[model samples]
Target: MLDTVGLTVAEGEVYRLLLVTESASAEEISGSCELDTAAARRLLLALEAKGLAYPVEDSPGWFAAIPPEVALVPRLQRQSEALEQTRAAVLEMVQTYQRGARARVGGEAIEIISGAAALRQRLRQLQDGSRREMLWFCKAGYVAMPPESNQEQFAAHDRGVLYRVLYEQAYFDDPGSVDNVVEGVRAGEAARAVPRLPLRMAVSDRSVAVLPLASPGAPGSPRELKAALVRESSLLEGLIDLFERYWEVGAPLRVTEEGRIGGAGPEDAASLVPEDRHLLSLMVAGLTDEAIAGQLRVSKRTVQRRVQGLMSLAGVATRMQLGWHAARRNWL
Candidate 1:
C-alpha cells in the first residue's frame, strides 16, 4: 500500500519488517531481511530522514519504525492532491486536442488510428457500443484478440444482434483456430470460411468499419499493425457490399452433432441454408475433400462423416452415382 505513495520495493520491504519490531539493530535488520549489512544501515538512515524511523532512546545503534498510520497517511494524501491537479490539466489539454482534430479532419469520415494500442481501444469501444449487427473479415497477420478479451459480441448476440463472421482458410491452419467461432455459434452467431479474404476488418451495426492500413502478412507482433476507421459513408457502404459478396461464397461453420441435414425430400431445396447448398455446389464443382474442408472451417474428418451420412440417406453407393441419385431425391 505504501508503494502507491512512491516507496521503492526494497524500502517497502524494510519498513514492513520494521513495523513488526519495537526496535532492531542493523545486524538484526540485515539478518531478518537477508539484506547486506551495509544496505540495511543505509535503509535505516534513509527511513530516519524520511520521518518513518528514529534512533532508539537508549540503544546507540538501533532504530524503531513509526506506525503506518503516522508515517504513510499524510504522504498518500499529498500524492492524491497532486494527482487531481494533473488530471484537471490533462482534461483541458484533451478538449483542445479534440477541437484541433476536428478542424484538421473537417467533413471527412475516415480516421487513422496511428498506434496498435489506440486501435485496440477503439475496436473495443465499437464492439461495446454496437446495437444491431456486426460483420468480420478475418485472415492471417492481423491483430490476434482472444475470445475473452472482447466478448461484447457474444452479449450482443444474446440480445438478438446479428453477427456474421467470415474467416480466410489460412486462419484454420492451427487445429483449435475455430474455438472462438464455436463459442460464437453456440451464442447464435453466423460464421463461415472462405479460401481468401480481401482484407481484415470489422464493421459494427453497419454504421462503422475498421480496417488495417495494410494486409497483415504473418503472425508477427500485433503492436506493429496500424488501422483506419471509417464511419457512415460511401466507403463504409462499399465495404459492407464486399463483405456480403464474400459471405455468399463462404462455407458455413458446422459443429453440430447431426450428420445429415434438411432438404431430404424432393421439394426441400428451399429448406437448406445457403451455406449447406454452397457445400453441395462446391462438391459438384469437383473440389477435393481437403479444399472443401478448408472452405468450410471444419476438419476433413467432419466433411467425410457428413458425406457418408448423406450417402446413407440417399441410398447410394459411390460418389459419382450418388450425385445423380441424390439430385433425383431432391437433395441439392
Candidate 2:
C-alpha cells in the first residue's frame, strides 16, 4: 500500500544512491545507474531541491553525495515541523473567517417588532424551532406567568432539546407562579431561580439570542426600545459565558410544600401540595407530560389535569402561548 506521504520512484532512487555512495561525477552516476546524462542531471537537481544532495564545487562536472543521516533526516524533520505549523496557522485563519462571517450575517437585521402579534410570532419561532439547547435568564415572576407558549414548550421537550432557565428567587413567593413552574418541571424542563440577573435574556440553541435593551424605567411606547438578536458565534460565545457565570450561582428548580415551586431549598415534604406545581416544574425543566408523571409517581392523566389547571390560571390557550406569556412576564 502507498504511504500517506507521497514519493516518486526516481526521487526515492536518487535519495538512496546519495545515502549509499560517496561523491561521484554525473557521467559516472549515469553510467553506473544505466541512465542517460540528461536524466541523471535532472535527478540530481531534483534531489538538490529536496535537500538530499549538494554539489561538489571543487570537482569539475561532479557532485557531492549528502548522507541521509546528515542531509535527508534533518531536512525532512524541518519540513515536517514547518508543515505542522502551517496547518495550525491555516486552521486558526479559517476559524477567524467563520466568526467574522457569522457576525456579518447576524448583525444585518436590526429590525423593530412593534405589534403584539408580530412579537408573538417572533417568540413562537424562538420557542418552536430552537435547536441544541435553550438558555434563559429572566425575572422569575415573569416566567411563572408566561403568556402563551406552554404547549409549545412541552412539544419542544418531547423533541429532546435542552431548556435551562434562570430567574429571580422572588418568583417562588406566589402560589400561582409556583404552580406554573411546577407544571413545566413535570414536563421535563430544567428550571432555576436566582437572587438576581442582569436582564431579560433568551438564547436559542446558541444560534440566536434576544436581550432587552430598554432599562427598567423606559417609557411604555418608546419607539427606540430595542433588543439585540445575535446569531454570530463570537457574540453567542460572550452571551453563553455571561449565562454560565450566573448559572454557577443560581439554584436548580425544585418543588415545595403547598403545591408551590422553589429552587434548591430545604425540603418541606409535609407542606408540599398535590397541585400543578410539580408538573410545571417539569415543563420548565424540558420534560414531557409522560415523563413528568413517571417522575412524580402519578398517572399521565393526573399530569395533564394539573397542566390544564395551570393553563387556566395563566389564561393561555396553548402551551406555546403559555411559554410566551411566561417569558414576557419573566416567569420561565
Candidate 3:
C-alpha cells in the first residue's frame, strides 16, 4: 500500500535499509536489503530523483536517506497534488458527457421496459398521468397481468378522459365479458370490436405509447416479459395514425337494457355474424369468461353479454342447451 507514495519495492527497501544503516555503499544496500547490486544502484537512483536519498561526495556509489519528515512527507504531498489534478480532469469529462446527452434530442426516444413488475408500474404511472384520451389495441398473446387492471380505466373514464379500445372477436367468447364492456360504455369508454387485432398497445394522451416487443409468434410470456416505451416522435405519430385507421373500421358497440345493441346485425342465433359465431364457438369450447376476455382482449362483461344474446335467441336457459341447440340448428 505504501507503493502509492511512488516508491518501487526495491527503492523502498533500499531507503529503509539506508535509514537503519545511516550510510551504505550500493553493495551494502544490496546485501542488507536482499537485492542485487545493480538493482540496489537503480533503487538509489529512483530515491534520489524523488529527493529521498542523496549521494555521498567522498563515496561515489554510497547513499544516505533524508529524514522522513523532510523526504517522505514532500513525496506524499507531490503525489496528492497529482491525484487532485486527476480528479478534476475526471469531473470535467463527466460534465462534458452529460451536456452532450442533454443536447441530443430524440437520442433516447424509445426505451426498453423489461420485467413484468416494472412494465406494470410504468404502465400505471403513464395511465395515471394521462389527461386526455387513451387508445388501446389488443389481441391474443402470451401475457399474465392483474385481473383488476380494467378497474383503473373506469376511474379514468369517469374523469372525462376518453377511452377507445379495439379487441379481437375472441374476447367475447367468455361469460361475464359483456358486463365489463357494458360498464365501460356506461363510464364513457368508446369500445369497439373486430375479428382480430395485430398488437397489444396503449397510447396515453398522444404523448406516449407502450407496446410489447415484436416477437416471431406470440408477443411475450409472463416468464420472459419485455416491452417498450416510446415518447412523442415521428414513430409515435405513425402508431397514432395506425390506431385511427383501425378505429375507422372497428365495429362500435354499446350496452343497452334490452337484448339488442348496435354493431353488426343478425336476426337470430342461427344467423349471427361470422365474428359472433366465432365467439360462440369459443364459448362452446368451454373457455371461462375471464380467459376468453384475455384471449380476445375484451372485458369479461362484454363476453357475458354476447353469450346472453345468443342464449336469448336460441331460447335456451343454460349454456349447455344453447350449445346443443346451436349444433342442431347448424349454427357455426
Candidate 4:
C-alpha cells in the first residue's frame, strides 16, 4: 500500500522492517526481506531519497524509518491534490477534443452512434461524466437498454447528479414500468408524465445530449437502432428548450406510503383519495378509458362509473366540463 505513496514494493518492505527496530543494517534488511545485500542497500537508499527512511550517523549503513504519520500522510495528500488537478485537466481536454472533432467533421456537432450496444455505452458515458443535472424524455418503447438495465442512473444519483425525467403516458403500458419509475423516484429521481413525447432523449449537464435519429415507427431491430450524440451546439440548446417546455406541462408523479405510484395532487384536492387523484391525473394526461382501466386494474365499467361520480361531485354534465372544473379547482 505504501507503493501508492511513491515507494517501491521492495522499498516499502525495507521501510516496514526499519519501523520495528531502532536501526537496521543492509544485511539485516536483506535477510528479513529475502533480498540480496546490494538490492536491500539500493532499496534503503531509494526510501531515504523519498524521505521515508534516513541513515543513522552513529551507525554507518544502518537506517531508521520516519514515522508514517510524518512521512506518508503528506505524500498521500499531495497525490490526492494531483489527482484532482488531473481530473480537471482531463475534462478540459475532452472539451477541446470535441470542438476539434466537430471542426474536422465539417462543423457537424452531432456524431452518429450506430447499434444498440454503442447507444447504451454512450448513455453510460454521459451518466458517468455528468456533474450537475440530467434531463430525460422516456418514450414507450426502449431503443437500446431497458429501464432496469440502466444501473448508471442509480450510480449517478448517488453522486449527487440531479435527474429530471419525463415519461410518456403510454410508457406505463409496459409491464413493471410503473414499478421501475416508482423505484427511481424513491431514489431521488424527479419524474413526470405527459400525453405524448416528440422523441426519446437524454441530456447531461446542459452541454451534451443523446437522441435517436430514426423515426419512431420505422421498422428496425434493436441492433439496428441509430442515435446521435450531440455536443455543445445550437441543436443541443434547442433540445434542452424542448425538454423544459415539456416539463412545464407534464403531470408530476409521487410514490405513496403504500409504495404505489400516485399523482401529486394540489393542496385544494386534499379531500380526494389517492386512487381518485391518480385516475384524474391519468385522464388529464390523455389516457383513454381502456388505458386508464388497464393502469388502475379495473373494468371499463368501473372506470366509467368512477368518472361519473367525479363529474357529479364537480357539478359537471360532461367529461370535458369535468376536466375543466378539475383544472380550475386544482384537483390535480
Q: Which one is best on TM-score?
A: 4
User: Residue 23 CA error for candidate 3 (Å)?
Assistant: 92
Model 4 clash pairs are none
Q: Arrange candidates by TM-score, highest first: which order?
A: 4, 1, 3, 2
Higher-lDDT candidate among 3 and 4?
A: 4
- Candidate 2 at 87: error in angstroms? 38
lDDT on C-alpha atoms for all candidate structures: 0.71, 0.63, 0.71, 0.83
Which number leads on lDDT?
4
Q: Kindly list the per-residue Cα lDDT of model 3 for residues 1-332, writing each as its tens digit.
A: 55887777767777788899888888987777567889888888888888889999998988888988997788789988999999999999978855663233376677777667767777777777888999988654324343235566877766778989876665555445555556777778787666667778899999999887754255555547778788889989999999998776565564444422232224345367855765654554345677657656789999999889989988999976775566456453
Could you estimate the TM-score for every candidate? 0.51, 0.43, 0.46, 0.70
Worst 10 residues of 3 by lDDT: 259-268
RMSD of each: 10.2, 15.3, 19.2, 6.4
Off by over 4 Å in 1: 1-97, 101-106, 217-224, 258-332
lDDT string, candidate 1, 121-197, tens digits: 88888888888888998775356454446677877876778889887766654444546555666778777666678
- By lDDT, is 1 or 4 better? 4
TM-score of 3: 0.46
